[model samples]
Target: MSDADTARRALALLDLTDLADVATADGARDLCRRAVSGPVPVAAVCLWPRFVAVARQALGDSPVRIATVVNFPEGDTPIAPAIRETEEALEAGADEIDFVLPWRAVLAGQLTTAGAMIRNVKMRCGDKLLKVILESGEYPDLDKVRVASELAIAAGADFIKTSTGKTARSASIPAARAMLGVIGMTARPIGLKPSGGIRTLADAKSYLALADAMMGPDWATPATFRFGASGLYTALIEEIGGAAPGAPPRGSY
Candidate 1:
């Protein structure tokens, strides 16, 4: 596919879970409702462990998968517990799992611990999709990011995500440039989701553009690219419809 085609495909993989909201499913479904009825249809709804069912019920066979976070905003848990969380999340009806690598372990040079956690979760989840959030803004080095991306992919992460959407900063094209390079090295078609604080349609387009430029035509589309935004879909709808005739009202799912 052409680069432009790839970009369009990448643009479709966005999910707008709340930035700082509780991980419960009701809050997630509320957000999902707003996003789906808006201009851009989110491919998934992400929430906490207790509410994956709520998201599943709310989204109900819309083809928008239910997503849950594991070891969540803080990636500090040990391997066994994280894996246990994965099991509970799956039972709760999660179609995808987003986990953060333990920064402390990585900083202490425990690459083995960081890697093993992801590998174990993947093994337990089986065919379920796993997204390993890099939390790039907190880490001080790109080398660590590179290592995390590589290890996560090798360990079976379906996507190498940029942030948990809880940090002060969100996804950066430059950071994405680096991760995408690593992701591009693999043939299994890993995804890149530059989530957090991307509140405008233009920002979404920018990430899409960067992914197209970095990963070539194969990386375009929801399967290989994703965005985890919260309130950003509201702006996307307004922007998409303002230029056209008869647009729907702005929403808050």
Candidate 2:
């Protein structure tokens, strides 16, 4: 298969409705329904741990996967609590969990400590997919982005995401490239999420391009890439030549 074909397949496997920042159950359901109803086959509805049940219940028998956030934007939680949060979310019907790696842990230069925390959470969840949020937009340099991605992958994340949409800046091509480089060099079959500020088809397509450019054609598929956004898909759908109904704009954190 060609690079474009591989990238297209990867795009199809993505959980495009990553409204993880949606703060309420009703809002989550609305986005979940919007996600499921769209022309694209969204892999999942990503949300806060508090609403995993709401999304799972709302999605019912649909093919969409149910995912929830762990420590969220800050990634400041203690390890024990973070692990507990993962378990709670799993019990609530989350098939995937995205954890924000502790910025303090990474900043204090406790990279291994952060990885170990993620490892424990992965252990607790077993086969459930885990996407570790690097929150690259807040880091001091691209090296931090590189280090964190390696740490998260080493810590056992099934994927390494670029940001928490709660941050002022979200995923960028530089950050995505930094993460993908490490994953490719290691030949680690992990996922990537270029999330946060992505709001239009252009933003999504650019990130998709970054995936192809950075990870090469073969690994750019949906199984390896995701977009974490609040109101991105609606505009993306419209831009992609579809008359898909829109989701209400994100109102709060």
Query: Any runs in candidate 1 off by more than 4 Å, and if so which?
Result: 1-11, 22-26, 242-253
Off by over 4 Å in 2: 1-22, 251-253
lDDT tens digits, residue span 178-244, model 2: 8888888775589888877776656666777777777676666557888776566556555555665
Model 1: per-residue Cα lDDT over 1-253, one tens digit each: 4433333343357675653453444456566576466444667766677777777778776777777788877888877888888998898789999988786677778888788888889998888889999888777778877877887888789998988877786578777888988987898878888887676666777887787677664556767777886565545555454322222122212
For all predicted structures, in order, the TM-scores are: 0.86, 0.89
User: How much is the lDDT of residue 110 in candidate 1?
Assistant: 85
Model 2 TM: 0.89
Top-lDDT candidate index: 2
lDDT of 2 at 229: 64
What lDDT does the true structure give each of the candidates?
0.72, 0.76
TM-score of 1: 0.86
Model 1 lDDT, full chain set: 0.72
How displaced is residue 11 in candidate 2, in Å? 7.0
Among all windows of 10 consecutive residues in model 1, the one with the lowest summed lDDT is 244-253
